[model samples]
Target: MNNAKRRIDLVLLPIVLLAAILNGYGIWNDQYANSYYTTAVGSMLRNFHNFFYASLDSAGSVTVDKPPVVFWIQTAFAYVFGLHGWSVILPQVLAGIGSVLLIYFMVKPTFGLAAARISALAMATVPVVAAVSRTNNIDSMLVFTLLLGSWFLFKGTKQGSPWRILVAFALIGLAFNMKMLQAYMILPAFYIFYMLAFQAKWRKKIILLIGSTAVLAVVSLSWAVTVDSIPESQRPYIGSSETNSVLELAFGYNGLSRLTGQQNRAAGAGMPNAADDRNNRDNASASVQGSGQTGNSAPSGNPSDDVGMGEMGRGMNGMNFPQGGQMPNGGEMPNGRDFGGGNGGGMGGMFGTGEKGLLRLFQTELSGQASWLLPTVLLGCIALFAGLRRRNITMKHKEAAFWLIWLLPVGAFFSVAGFFHQYYLIMLAPPIAALTGAGFVAMWKAYRERNGWQAWLLPLSVMFTTIFGWYIMQVYNDTIGAGWSISELIAGFLMTIILIVMLNSSHPWKQGMVIAGFMVMLIGPVYWAFTPITYGGNSMIPAAGPTGSNGMFGGMGMGGRQGNGNVGMTPPNASGDADQSFPSSSSDESDVDNSGTGTPPASGGNMFGGGGMGAAGGRGGAGSRNEEVDTTTLNYLREHNTGETYLFATTDYNQAAPYIIDENEAVITLGGFSGSDPVYTTEELEELVQSGQVKYFMVGGMGGRGGNSDISNWIVEHGTEIPTSEWTTGTDSGAGFGGQSTLYEVKL
Candidate 1:
């Protein structure tokens, strides 16, 4: 019997892992997330592994927003493939898939095969899980590294492998570098409780504690030195301390300042998160601790006073509060992020006037900020249930409680930090999934004890059926649209019926239920892979990209609206309006100290910022360089001497498009977008053309910003016909436009 079980485990492990991988495949078909470009891709380009590839800043300082451990994978790819989109993001997708597999491995002993399989399947199809798994971002890396570290510790304790403890601690170090200290949340607490519960011997205890600490210090501190060695100027700060530079910006203040209001930057259009975080920290600390971070101010007479009772003080007791003036009627927010002025304090106006000078507290607080506590309450219930059946639960749980305990901290950490993004809590979903799967088995047995199987089976399965329907309609709607064919519809219904017939019964029934669920969802997801994707559940890929740099990812059916009321994608190059200016700056490090002797590279300015090539910018004179390049592209542009320039359009509507990688194959879909997708902005086109930099412009579906104002007014006004012979902007050498786009060129 034991040999047969071992054989079965070996066979099923590969099958399950392969399926998890397939779940992430085709996720990069469109731009779906933001970090793909800024943090993830930037890391790939700047670091060629060997610690620090080259600093991005021209002054040559260490860039330290994120730890280098995660970037190591991204840079390794960049070293060979040259910082293309696909290569940078692929690692994230694999890591996400790997995390799912790890969850299954961790929970299998406690939950039994049927429950473990169901949990993995649920995780694979859960909408947020599926969406995040496909992007090039650190959140997935954070989760994977955390789980890897947990599995090592849990398995090591059970298997008596001390080496595994060192490895787990090392992973925690890597996770710290990937996403700050959030990686270490479970350690001290988990260790203390585990030791007390398991009754550790002194030698074993010292080895686990001391050796793990040493491993952590070595792995984590190395990145600290490499990052801290950087100078101050290259760092980004509306106003954060240097001891608190981008390093603090990325990890500490970067994450916590937003919630605590250290940076006064508010959430909204025109307001970067920096201001709310930078300023609010002082304000919030003042409000909560009385005087300031120095711990001055007097204690409040009432523990539930205004600021104390209101949104700002919600986290003092591990609560989440609404930001700004919330709806009086207790309405839910559209997005988890609060886009208002008064910071994370709920109903900003209600508490008092929007006073930067004083911290005013309100009596009533809403529920969002405190959302992290939901899992704790859930764990409490689970613990109570397990305690009732302590004998049954103990032997059935190989390491189930360990995983449950580990999963609980992510929420506690978020709650204490007071930073709340609904989906950021998606990190908690895997464990919840594991718990629920295991819980169902335990619940089913209890239910059967009361009602002899048949009575409970139909209702329980129906409940799952209802949950899946909700997921399809709301969560997975991007893939499985409102439209369901007869075959899919019938299969879905039949599967539900089969589950109803089998639920709450023993293993045979559970096996049948799973097989039916797998067949139904597994096939439905494959269909979602090829269809036109949506953004926030609206529109196809934009003709124009999103607002600002590295804004929204993925294709929306209609072009995305910009924050400045530019309706539909990135504004085109053709703009007479100075209100809409290019992101150009004298400060772009790419331009400083660069001296190219020959014809300048496609980039408009010299490689480094200071001094110009030739007469002003490069070694070659301005007029002698090739004049046939495109000016419409983002990220890079090649300059020509004849007053004409070309844009390869590297940053498509959203830079989700691919660069001209040789052989035209994507390394990874950064946000799952090819970046080659056709997109344009009339504002960008007109502005460059009028300035004489844009002799020709590439026009496609991307030019919908400000609601056709550029094309209807500016492009139509400034553009005129010229013969092909004189049209050196290459209007005739037309590039094929794809995905609801039209290409056009202008003559100067």
Candidate 2:
């Protein structure tokens, strides 16, 4: 047993190291990566108030959409590591590596050493796993937590310790705090698995189940309950919920709305009409029917609503522009730009909106990332059932049943569910990896033990995986290009030949063939995973594949340089009207500073040059310039400050985060993300200004959410814009496209 254990450890060592390296490599390059969460991390570190509320600003005005569990973990690390990007991201990297190990241990007892090793390797090489682990995304921590729960539950069943089962359920509850309803996705699987596999008597088992569930419910709601119990006036506004309730957030925006496709009233892109009728009614006066934006709605009568339209004549009459409700005379209101448009490819495929039900998971966008070995795992599950059918359900068969159950419900939910993201696929990885490892071991054993149809199972699994891989290459051909297809085909053919050799060859050659075949099966995703690292992968949307031009992975590379164009997921001409793709240069050259502000310098052109919705390299118009707060602006705010809590105010966290990171000052965001969440009313902000709590207001470009109309209108009507000449410095005036930051002074 000792010798066997050592050999298993040796076999697993390399894959573990590879996974660790992939997850940690070059993780620090994108400083303040994904300003959305990074901003929150910086703010949460400010005080206990920000920490508890998970506020976007140190002032504790508004909170991030999700709960604070992941942030708590990140904050602990940031405390020690000094708030650098790596400080927050490193915890996720370690969590990812630990998850891989847990999956190995979780499967080894039932599947044997061979299956355990394979499962770990499969997870280690999965692209989405690599992507999420490397970024500051909370999903990695969430995935790791679930895997840990699985480990404890497996141990509890084998040992008959209700304590272990309690711990397992408790951890799942903690995971709920990490991502709300998403953490409970695996609960049904846990319940069924425990009931079938535990050694307890029927009555005891029922009691254990009920008690553990109670523990889960309590642990899950602990944070939500605490936050909600506080008086509304005392705590930060609960973000992204219809009512200002965390429970509603759990059930609505983060729960049913996710499944039902109801856009979050306070988060996401444009405020779609699909939102609850209450949101529409609440913002009725300000709400315009459509400007084609998604996350937050820009209000009617704001000149910003008609930004960049050559034909201002479209709806000028309806707009109540801040300047006495008069429309800014037409021919495009300088630098007005559109974002997040275009028909993304894979729209009609299996996992796309076009493909409605179970077949969706089989599509290219998903299949290539998490399902490389899906067919193999499914076959393995079937074989496990067949081999043990004659025997009464015992520990062995029950264990296999547990994995199958785990795979089925979650797989079915994501398959037919309305919403899907590449990162969400990480939740499915463990089960898929487990079955692949154990199932492959089972097939290999059946093949060795007999000269029956089971022998064909191993080869059949490889062939199926290869065929699916080929189809994935074809589907993503636009992003990855035809060149990748040829390589994948060549690899597939080579894998086929190796399988044949293994079937006919003697012992020594057979072992080698097995290694070669596994490598061939994994080569594509492995190669894809490394490509993201080589390019400083941006975490805009964590995914695995060739880098797209300013896409999730590709944009993570050095300063927004176009990706290799190898990734074909993006459709050619999918982005509508190239002319409108980016904001054109302004004739007013005064707003730009030629001085070296760092890299491209602080100017209009650099700001709008190459960013948009989901633009690669983290340079989205408003989001692109967050890492570097303009020193000039920072200095001016510092020079003209009152003894107040916040340094200044912006519509959202985009502009505020830079100051928080660079100046160590709290910047109030009037609206939450996209300026959508109603954190404070106009009167409330006016009171803040009156009391000298927040004295400076910054408004340039679109006010996030529906903030621009109200705040912009109020500031213009009640406050004054400090001209670029007075407050700013450099060869250019301080203004440019959507990315430029303009300052204003509001009088109490």
Candidate 3:
């Protein structure tokens, strides 16, 4: 028996390590929606505090929406890898791995081996969980801390030990330190629900509950207390004042404003009426409407409703600029201009003033945000009552009561949010994973009675279906968010129906349903992730027009500089405009600058020019000039025979330097000659390829800011833009005349 148990342990340990290893691996470029710098910056800032009690305030402030736990994690990486990319995120990868192991162990004791394994695998690959791992945020780590808290709480109750209580409280505190109160609320809420529903011994439950709550209060409050005790200058940017302000914003202005045309989060974008109504009335607003607590509607003759065009005139829709509001002449407003108040003149009130009364009301209504889990949170509260009242609590029910209480506190915290993202769903999964795993284990006799041998079909079907479900969900999410093709949507829909049918049919149909479901869900994601089908076969490259107008920089940023684009998913440009595709970003010069050539400086990193975004990186002011491309670009020429990278050739800071330096990745300017200037001859451009120095001659097309049509004539004369004679040419490409841009690659 001992040897058999040892052999089983050997197999299990490897599985746990493998899952954790994959969980901790590096995130790709797109998972962050192409924004790794935010976490990198946050890590650097908090890492500063990890060393000393110092105040930091200067040179353009940056703060994330959450707390310092994530920063601390990255700070650890900073200690190991220095403050930069990939390394700082390595710890999270480990936490992710740890989470998988924790899930397996937490469930294993309750659910038995099979269910625990499936639970581990299930949490590891779920779309949202996958996203959290790939992101540079706190969700994954929070999931870890929550898992730890839940496990130890279960242990304490089961073993009649206070050490486990300390561990649980410590985990709660760590989670609180990580992302503020969300973890605190989310976990405890779930624990309470489990306790009340099952544990009948009220008095002992009460004692354990109070003991755990007291323990949690002490554990979680230590950091806040320590930070609070510090002098102002010492821990300047490191506490929870903004947390309340943001909650006010979320529940007050951002929340209340959404009811009418007031707090539109996407205020300026001018979503189509249909989409806007659907978004506003469909998901968020619908709940408010159902509750019958929605506020007053905007009056027809309200002056703010009569708002004009320009900055102030920017209607409730935000896309609307004020008519006579700002610049009377209709041009740029002064620097740091405030669109304060509303459409008329008073502050547009995005986040209204934080009156205590209003915040209370907001918090009250906002309590319903996590309504789904509140009742459960309450039950765990009762279970705590039973534990505390006990004299001799040696039963399994008493132990389950402990886990129920611990988890409830954390779960209820996030449930209070007005909105929930996939990351928010993180807290729920671990407990559910454990519950599902363990519940299935405890109810084996029952499930066998309820499902019998057919019960075996349950997991097999869910596994196969979940794999399928993941694909369909990806296509649906990617397409909707990224706007993929009509044909792609049709294919996705068809596959979804097949999977739905397979899952819903009777017993005999289960096998066929599972198989067919798997095939359909597998289709789009696999093809998109792996194939050259190009953004779901819609030609990531735009179709050519009859006017023979090739687009800017061949076919690069037009695909997307963020989100889906970074993931090789090209954005849609239905308006015939190159700019309005995927993830609406401010054409902020910084975005254009960073997206173009110059490398982003390392933390606290000032640029060295050629397009550096350091303190003097040509970001602001009237006409500053400190841009420089990478020094590597000067010598980083690559072999083109294998043809891997794309290039944009330019010089003259005032001309193409900012845009091309990072965007096209300048290697060498082709002909028209000068250092970093257009210099290579067609033959020289070709020779650079032979020398493994250049692959593209990145020249000018119309709308290109500087330079000439010579590069254009050059491209047409020597290269091909896209494939297919009919659709490839800029002219006679059918009815879509003057509708597209052309990009020519020199075959040389």
Candidate 4:
């Protein structure tokens, strides 16, 4: 037994290492994985007040949109490691690795060693899972938490221990604090598993289920109740809630908005109307086209035309065509729309989730992320139940049903839900991994026994899944090259043929053929998983693919160029230092050092105080950079300080993130993230200024989400405007506030 356990441990070691390497390698290069959350981490480190609230700034002005559990864990890691980019990312990486191991342990006792190993491998290789785990986003941690709950739930059901079942629900409630309602998506599976597997009278089982639910409610609402009980004056305002209430924020923005496509309304009371958004988008499009360069620029007049296809396009072309393959008619190929941009059909498509339908998961925008193994999962479900009879239900059959229940509701949600990011696909990983692993073993046993139609199910499953993988590759052939699809097609067919031949004879390598068939199915997702490390991924969006410099889905759709926006157009200085250029409105390029250090050239006068429109600014917004507050600006703010509570005030979190991260000082964010939240009104700003809690106000940047226009106007009317030369280096590019930024000194 000890020797067998040692062998199992040796195999598990490599799988864990694979997950760790995929999630942690070169993470420091990102500097700030997602500045929004990174800023919150920095603020949380300042004091217990901000820490408890998950505040976005040190002043405890407003909490972040989600609950505090994940950030609380990240905060602990940051505190110990001094808050570097990798420090915060380390927790998620470890969580990701832990999840992989959990899958092995969960499946081994019931499904055997081979199934457990396969499940672990499937979880580790999922592209979306790895992509999200590499960043500071809460989804990876949320996934790990949910999986932990599943572990306890599974154990409790097997042992028929009511105490363990109670503990399982409590852990799930803790996961609710990690991501709100998203954690509850798996509850149906938990309830069904316990009801089917636990040994008790029907009435007694129902009563225990009710008691467990009561425990869930208590653990889930503990933090929200504590937070909402605090008076408005004592604690930070709920960041994304309409009524400054935690429960409202949870049920509204984080709950109903996820399914109803009403995110704009639930996000906050104030948002830019359609006309303003259209005008801004139009102006941003014109700026991109007028200047021949593209780097983090916003979408153009047609949102579909804004696909950024620079490096990935070239890479694909090099792979497919011996001589450089150019799009016919000067970089114009078929219009495949933006890979994951634009509202393809509905509100969900706006955030790159693709249109709502049965086929939504299979669409190119999402398929490469987590759906590659879905075909196997569906066929494997059939294989698992092929020989089971209703009168002879077993624990294994009950467990199979548990995974199916977990998968269907969650998969159905993503299929039809109106709002979610691509990385949210991680929710589908666990069940798919488990079903694929367990089903493979079941199918293999039937094949060896030659159990009628079940014998053919194994080969059919492999062949169909391989074909589906080939189709996914073909869909992206224009961007990622047809070479991969063609290679996989040949290999998959050869393996299928060999497996079929081996089934007819008492072949010694039949198990080897089965493993090869699984490998053939995995080729596409493995490549997709590796792309993030090969080409940098979007830390903000956390999608797996080649995103180019614009950091959206690049080269995954059709077309090369010839749009209002420079979708596939490479910048003239593509090979030069990225910090030297800014997306300007004029055709002539500025020689400004965009690192916010050097003075602007005399020919290119400072736009710091000018009315000229520059690029859209924010961490993941078009034309933005992950830059810190320049030394000159930091020095100026420090010198002018009058012991105010806040060092300065800005229109939104985008404008304030850099300063908070650089100095860990309080910088008031009038609006929440995206500048859309009605965090404060002009009257509140007046009160803050009068109380001497805030003295400096920076306004008129592209980052203003229009909710705080009144505050900007009030500052310009009453405060003294400091000249651009006072604080800014002439070449100062707004860290997140695009265009020109003006500093105003508001007096008492």
Which candidate tops lDDT? 4
> Each model's C-alpha lDDT?
0.36, 0.60, 0.34, 0.65
lDDT per residue as tens, model 1, 339-366: 2323434322212112222211111111
lDDT, candidate 3, at 213 = 74
Segments in model 3 whose C-alpha atoms lie over 4 Å from true places? 1-65, 188-205, 225-417, 435-748
| Candidate 2: RMSD to truth | 7.9
Q: Which pairs of residues clash in candidate 4, taking residues 3 or more apart in a chain or in different chains?
A: 296-622, 296-623, 297-623
10 residues in a row with least lDDT, candidate 1: 585-594
Residue 457 displacement (Å), model 1: 9.7
Error of 2 at 623 (Å): 5.5
What's the CA RMSD for each of the models? 15.9, 7.9, 18.5, 8.5
Across residues 1-748, which tens digit of lDDT does each residue of candidate 4 receive? Answer: 9888866667788989999988888776655556667778889999999999998777787777778999999999998888766787789999999999998999998999989999999999999888778877788888898889888888888888888889999989999998899999999999888988999888989998999999999999999999999898898878757788999877876687667645333224433345554454345423422332111112111011111222112112211111233323343222334422244432344334566788889887788889888877887778888768989888889888988999999999988776566778899999989998999888888888888888887888888888878887787576578888887888888888887888878888888888888988888888877666765454555566543221232232111111112122222322222222222210000000011111212111111212111111222222232234556677888889988889888754545766777577788876655444556777888999888898997664433333444455566667887766777766444422234456778996
lDDT per residue (tens digit) for residues 335-361 in model 3: 122223221122212111111221221
Off by more than 4 A, model 2: 1-8, 264-354, 474-484, 494-507, 549-562, 566-623, 702-708, 729-741
